[model samples]
Target: MSKKQKRVLIRILISSVLFAAGEVLIITGSNPFNEASLFAFFLIPYLIVGGDVLLDAIKNIIRGQIFDENFLMALATIGAFAIGEYPEGVAVMLFYQIGELFQSYAVNASRKSIASLMDIRPDYANIEIDGVLKQVDPEEVSVGDIIIVKPGERIPLDGVVKEGTSSVDTSALTGESLPRDLSEGNEALSGCINLNGVLSIQVTKEFGESTVSKILDLVENASSKKAKAENFITKFARYYTPVVVIGAALLAIIPPLLIDGALFSEWIQRALIFLVVSCPCALVISIPLGFFGGIGGASKCGVLIKGSNYLEVLAKTGMVVFDKTGTLTKGNFKVTEIYPAKGATIHKDEILKLAATAESYSDHPISTSLKEAYGIKIDRKQLESVEEISGYGVKAIVDGKRVYVGNAKLMEQCSIDFERKTTPGTLVYVAIENSYAGCIVIADEIKEDSADAVVNLKNAGVKRTIMLTGDSKAVGKMVAEELGLDEVYAELLPADKVNQLEELIKQKRLYGNLAFVGDGINDAPVLAEADVGIAMGGLGSDAAIEAADIVIMDDRPSKIVTAIEISRKTLKIVKQNIILALGIKGIVLLLGAFGMATMWEAVFADVGVSVIAILNAMRALDVSRYQG
Candidate 1:
């Protein structure tokens, strides 16, 4: 509880005791109204509990905001006092205050859940200055400066490890429980806990540009972007409160004048009850609170929803489009197959070694895979006069021999008649001195959870799941078939991906939206063009994260299903609160107008419904167990 809440709680306890004693005295005594001392004693407790509400009502009235719940509550209680129902007036105000306290407490608790995500911000960074380690603010650390991280300390900036090896816990950033192992030359992002070793790291980004700071900024400003449903409630209350106030006035006045048997006092009492029950407190408080809770719950599960508006859009998603490389697949290439031509006398390992040696100076992923497959250090001194062909591959002189490594086009240009390998992967053609050597096939491995992600999304009511990629048709078709995707588009450039997304958006069902998931720098345009852009944040580029509407911190495609489920469940709770509040209020408003209901029922209709709806909204916070 906050300090203000603690003080309000104390006041509630004190006032409840005094009110109980006053009630007993009133029942035991002859006439409390005739006794000035007893009347003043009861009024003291009333003011003690409800002074803030009364003061707020008056302040708002002066500010020209007269139709809010505070005004309704204050007016109804004062009306009770006017009618000489002092006990009823005091009890109504007391319960109203209690309801407000409950609301404040619930809101604060939900804020804490959302705010816990901000704990990743580091308090300080450790930098060595002339052999002396000094602690300073992370903002003071510059790029390229070497910083040291000890065991159990958070890495304060994004950087590369220069020395030492350790396991770092990334659960706070990624929501994955496993600790990632890091060694020299490995990259380490901020907000990760260095688990077991003292390491020296070269800072690559300043404090503001780090991943932790970016996430904090995104979360802190999220609430400013309201969902469509929340905006409706705001406008609904603006008009609804004033219309009810006018209706209560007409009920109190026109009925007494029109009906022959209607007494002014009875109709006035009904009008007071009407105003109390008419306050739009339940709808106003619970709808946005529910969205806020949903965002918090998603963050707990390693998904960052940019705003409530995006959450609303995600619930309406019927189609999901995916990028191939780093999204559904691991993005790491491996040499899975090798074929030697009939006349080539080289072994499979020899073919791989030649390709690895020729591509030693290249930093492409395919190059890396070839090097890794060779499993031996390359002698860079043997590679000479390397030239990169933009549309194909590299040409290098290896060990005093002219070696060419590229696609079929390079071999065709070199006049080498090579046997074309038809496979669902990237094929590299190697030619020695214009003679066809062999081919090495490298393929990207799909993620284990990707198939499950497709199934779960389908089960969650997604109409279609599609894959878009820059790979060949065969490779795209192979992955699509394995994952059971509905459609696949291959050999698309960055702009083509956006065109496909636009077409998919047009194909969506009326009221349904399209979501695009990606994890590469080239995917940024498509991510921004889709209705909901989801990024794989763990290994995704900064451009992708900046453009995406939601980020899966762990880079698991299955989390998209979890995110969709959270959105749907949150929308369900919001709709429930709306229906429950409106239904109960509508029925009781009729009863109160006809004199069938009393002031006690009016209090329940106003504060009781609000408390129930608020409790229902709280359910959106516990969505960790919600699975598609």
Candidate 2:
């Protein structure tokens, strides 16, 4: 318990002792005081337990805010004291204090749970200056600076390993226990711990732009965006409290006047019970706590939901659209096949060498694959001039021969007749001196979990699954069929992807949501246009991550299923709390107004219901049952 809660507990113990002593004296016929003096005796315990509540009520009344829980509590207990029910008034305040203490403890535990899940923030970066290691704030570390990470420290910035090899634990960032081994030239992200070897890393990004910083910013601001259920409760309490107070007042006055020989004290006691049972503490506190716990649970599964609003939308997702490259596929292209022209004397190695040399200056994935296949040095001196044709290919002069390396469009643009090949992988046509040459086949492998993700989404009751890609029709169809997607739209540009998503949005169910997942910079527009934008954060571009509403930190498609499960569970718990609080209060409220209930029953209606609802809200934080 917090120190503030500790003080409240001490006050409750002292007040209970005094209240019990007064009751014992009265029952034993040994009361030392008259009726007025006995009331004053009980006032000591009442003020001791509820002084802050009474003061708060008075302050709020002065500030034109007289219809809150504090006001209801203060009015009801004070009315009890006025009618010679001093012991009941003291008891009400003591029980209310106990409920408030439990509330404080529950909120604190939720906050600590979320704090521990996002505990990846580093305290300092180790930089070597003059062969001596010095610790500095992460913000002070600049790009290109070589920082040292020992076996037990977190990588403070995003960088590449320049020296040493180590096993890195990314469980804090990805929620997966498997450690990745990093060697020289491998990229190391922030928030991962170096487990064994000391590593020297050349920083590629500053602290502000690192992965850890972005995640922290997302989590800290999550509560600012409230779910619809939370908004309803805020408005409900605002209007509900004032109306109940007026009803209580009318019950206290109108009943005594209408019924013959009705005693004022008896009806007044019923009004006080009505007021106690009408406090909206359970609905007000438990709903938001449930959503907060849900977000923390999602972070444990490597999913970062921006706010509760997005979490709600995720539960209603009926359609899921995916971008092919870097999302469902590994996105690592390799030279799978090399085809030589049928009538040409050029060998396969010669075709590969010419294409690799002419396209050596480009950094595109296809170009990199060709260079990797050649596996030899390219002499740039043999090239006279090189020109790039966007969306086609490259034209260069190698050994004083005109060489054109690109797609079929490039071959046609140069007016070179080439053999057309119908292939399932990407095709690159090579032309030399305006003559036709063979084409190379490059392909990207599908991710191991892509099929599993599709199957799980279907099992989760998602109505449709689709893929939008810029790849050729042959390649896109192959991947879509392999993953068992329900629909596929291929050979689309960036603008075309958004248009397709808009058309899909029109076809979805009226209240259902559509989620678009992508990882490239080109996918940013389509991501923002979807009902929920999910980004693959592992190899995803910054533009995609910035526009996305939810991020899968480890680039696992399976985590989307986990996020949806968490959202549905949270909404179910919140609704359960609402019904549980209102159902019990409604029955007791009717009984209290009709004089069928007493002060002890009223305390149970308010304090006991709130404590039970809070305990139920805490269950949203347990996600172990959902994890495989």
Candidate 3:
């Protein structure tokens, strides 16, 4: 618990004890009204519990802010004291304090969860000066400086590893369980832990431009962007408070003057009840609390909701658009199928081996997949004069025989007749001595949870799932079919992707809103253009994450379903509180004005409804029950 919460709790305990002691004395034989000593004794506990409230009411009155809960509460309790109902006045203040404590506690709990996210801020950096390592503030380190990170230290800024190798625990940023292995020439982001082995990194970004700094800035400023529901409540309270105060004042004055035999004291009591019942505490306290809890719960699951407004819109999403590479697929090329052309003398294994040998000296993704598939170490001495034909493939002499590995363009260029194959991947054609050999199909592997992600999204009421990719139409169609997507738009440039998303958003407008998910630097614009921009924070570019309203920290598309579920549940809770508070207060207000309800019922309508609504709002924090 926070210190402020502890103090509120302590005040609650003290007030409760004093109120109990005062009640005991009243029941034992002390006449509060007749005996000065007894009245002072009872008044002591009332002042102990309500002194602060009365002082706040006076301050608000002096500042021209007279129509609020504090003012209403002070007016009602003091009116009860004037009527010699000391016990009722004391009870009203006591329960009001109790409700305030609950609100304070709930808000504090949410702030703590968000504060935990801010813990990723790095404190210092270790820079080498003349072969001596010195720890200094991370801001002092500049780009291109070599910073040494030891075991169990957070990487202070974004950089590339120049020396040594280690595993980095990226769970704090990504929310994944696996540690990413890092070696020389690999990029390392800030806010990740270097697990073991010393590493010398060449910094590529300043502290302000680093990934951690950007994320922290985004989170800290999130609450300034309020949801529609929150804005409605603010406007409602502003108008509602003043209207009820005027009505209560009219009730106290007009009834006694117009109606014969209507005593001023009795009418004043009814007006006081009206004021208490119309405080609007329940709606005012619970709506923002519900949204705050939703954001906190999303953070716990590695889904950072930038604001309640996005959370609200996410719940209304009917269509979900995705970028194929890095968002739906693993973005890593792998050899999934190998086919040899008809009439080829060489076997399937030989085709792969030759292609692997020709591409062994290359560092392309397709080349890496071929080498990994070969599984046998290549002897560089046997390969001679490897030459890369841009946009086609590679040419090299392997085992004293000239080998060629590339696409159909390469075959057409060499006038070598090759058999065409139907497959949804990047096919690398092989040839020896200008004769057609075979082909190897390499593709970006789909993530394991992608299929499940689609299923869960449909179950969560997502009407359409679409994919946009820069790959061939064949590859895009294959992935769309595999993932059960509704539509696929392929061969798109970054601008084409944005246009396609805009069209989809327009098409889906009649049904509901649309959400776009992506994870590359190229995806930043589309991420911002969508109804709700969701970025894969774990491996995503900083630009993409910054433009996004929601970030999936673990880079799992399935978490999109989880985020939608959380927003929907939070909206449900908020609506429940609003209806419950308004419904009950509407009926109680009529009863109080008609003199049918007593001060006890007015207290329940004021404090009791607030407490119940707050408890319901707290349900948004228990997000574990939501499996999606």
TM-score of each: 0.64, 0.61, 0.67
Q: Worst ten-residue run, lDDT, model 2?
A: 221-230
Which digits, one per residue and each the tens of the lDDT, describe model 3 over residues 1-628?
7787687677767877877877787788763546566557657777877788899989988999876667776776776676556666777777667656554554344222333434678999999888889999999999999999999999999999999877787644543223556778999989889876799999999999987776565544432332233455445646776787789889999999999999998888788778667766676567767887898888889988876777789999999999887889887778998877786668889888888988998765677889999999988898998887654567899998898898887888888888888798877888899888888888888999999999999998999999987677998899999999999998765556766877887786576888989886556557667778899989876666766778999999999999999999999999999899989999999998888898778768877887899899889988886544
Question: Runs in model 1 with CA error above 4 Å?
Answer: 1-230, 238-243, 342-345, 379-402, 422-425, 470-474, 491-495, 521-525, 624-628
Q: How far off is residue 406 in model 2, in Å? A: 3.3
After the best TM-score superposition of candidate 3, give how far the Cα of residue 376 lies from its true spot, in angstroms: 2.1
Q: On TM-score, who's better, 1 or 3?
A: 3
| Reference-based TM-score, model 3 | 0.67
lDDT of 1 by residue, 280-322 (tens): 5576567667777788889889988876667788999999999
User: Residue 113 deviation, candidate 1, in Å?
Assistant: 23
Model 2, TM vs. native? 0.61
Weakest ten-residue segment in model 3 by summed lDDT: 221-230
Candidate 3 colliding pairs: 562-628
lDDT of 1 at 585: 85
